[model samples]
Target: MNITIKGKVPPKAIIGVVILVIALALFLLKEPEKDDLIEISESDSIIDEKLEEGDLETTPVIQETIVVELAGEVNNPSVYILTKGSRVYEAIELAGGLTEEADTRNTNLAAILQDEMKIYIPSKEEVKAMEEQSGTKAGSDYIGGNTTANSSNQNKNSKVNLNTANSIQLQQLRGVGPSTAEKIIEYRNKHGRFNKIEDIMNVSGIGEKTFENLKNFITVE
Candidate 1:
C-alpha cells in the first residue's frame, strides 16, 4: 500500500506563518523592556525634581545687640549682652544691681547704653577722694563709655559731662543756665545721644563761640 498526502501546502503561506510567529515572539519579549524604560524615566524625573528643590537655600535672620561691661560696686560685675537701645540701669540690673558702697549720685543710670561701653560704679569714698584730688565738687553725672576699676566715674577731669548731666549738673557749666540745660536735655531727648561734645552746638543758642569756650570744660564721653 502507498502513502497518500491530505492537501497541497504553498511555500509562501508557510513562510508567512513563520514570519508572523517570529514577530509575535519579538513583540512579547520587547514589552517588559519598554515598561522598564518608562518606569526608570519616571523615577529619574522624580529624583531630578527632588535634587532641584534641594539646591535652593533658605535665608538666615540676624538681630542687633549691644555688649557692655559693668564693674566696681556692683554685686556681680561682668560683661553682658543686651538689645540695642538698652539703658545703663538695665545693664546695672543685669550685673546684680549696685552694692551699698556704690555712689548712685555719681552714676547716670538713665543714660542710653552704647556698644563696647564700660561702666564703673564708684563708691562714696572713691567719690570723696576724686573730689579731694580734683579740688572741686564732682558727682551727680557720668556719661557713657568709661573705664577705671576703682576710681570715681564722674570726674571727667572735673569738667561737666554734657551727655548725662541733669539740670543742676549742667548749670555748673560756665555759661549754661537753667534754660540752656533744659534745651540740651530736650535736644538729647528729641534726638538720641551726643555722639561728640561738639553736638551741643546743635542745641538752640549754644553756638560755635559757646562751644569753643565750653570745649575744654565739657565732654560727651
Candidate 2:
C-alpha cells in the first residue's frame, strides 16, 4: 500500500522509515549499560558503609559522665552522677557535705575519686568504737568502703584541720585525751581559732613535747 502526503510513497520506503523510528525508540528505552549500573551500586554501597560506621572521622557529641556513691555521715547519702575526672570532695559537696557527727580523722579527704566507687564517712561514735575494739588508733587515713582502684594519689595526704577539728577529732591527736581535747576546745572558744599549729601550746597541756609528737599529723584549715 502507498500513502499520499505531498506525493505518493512506496511501501519499501515507508517500511524503512518505520524501522528507523522503532530502532531509535528501542535505543532510548534500553536498559542502562553494565558500567553505569555498577557505578550507581558502588556509590550507594559507600553511603551505606559510612552510615553503618557512624562516620568515625566526624566527631560525635558524646557525654562522658561518671557515677559515684556516698554513704554514712553525709547530709544526703545516695548515689551521685558527676562529670568525668571528678574528685572525692566534689562528690561530698554534691552530697551536701559532712554531718556534725561525721568523723573525717581516719578519712583521706584529698583523695582523688573514681567511677562506681563507694565513699563511706564513718560516724564519731563508730570511730571510737572501732578504736576501742582495735586497742590502737585506726592508722589508715583512707576512706572506708569500695574505692577507685586505678586512681592516682595526686594530692598530698591530708592532715587533720586543726581549726575545724571537733573534740573527738582533736582527741585523735597524740597525747590528747578527752579532757585535753575539751581544754583545746575551750581555748578555741575563748581566744578564737588557732592561727597556726604552733599555737596549740597555749591550750594549757599541748607543750613543746606534745606539739613535736603531733605537729606532723595536724594542719590548719
Q: Pick the candidate with the highest TM-score.
A: 1
- Residue range 46-112, candidate 1, lDDT tens digits: 9899888896677987778988878788999888999888888998899988899998664557767
Poorly placed runs, candidate 2 (over 4 Å): 1-63, 135-221
Residue 76 local lDDT, model 2: 98
What lDDT score is found at residue 19 in candidate 2? Answer: 99
Residue-level lDDT tens digits of model 2 in 1-221: 99768967889999999999999999988968899999999999999999898886766687778777898789999999988766678889999999999888755565556566567777787766656532223322233223222112323334655555545556666688878876775565445557899998888867899899989988765
lDDT by candidate, in order shown: 0.73, 0.68
- Candidate 1, residue 214: how far the Cα is off, in Å: 1.8
The CA lDDT at 143 in model 2 is: 37
RMSD of each: 8.4, 15.2
Task: Compute the lDDT for candidate 2.
Answer: 0.68
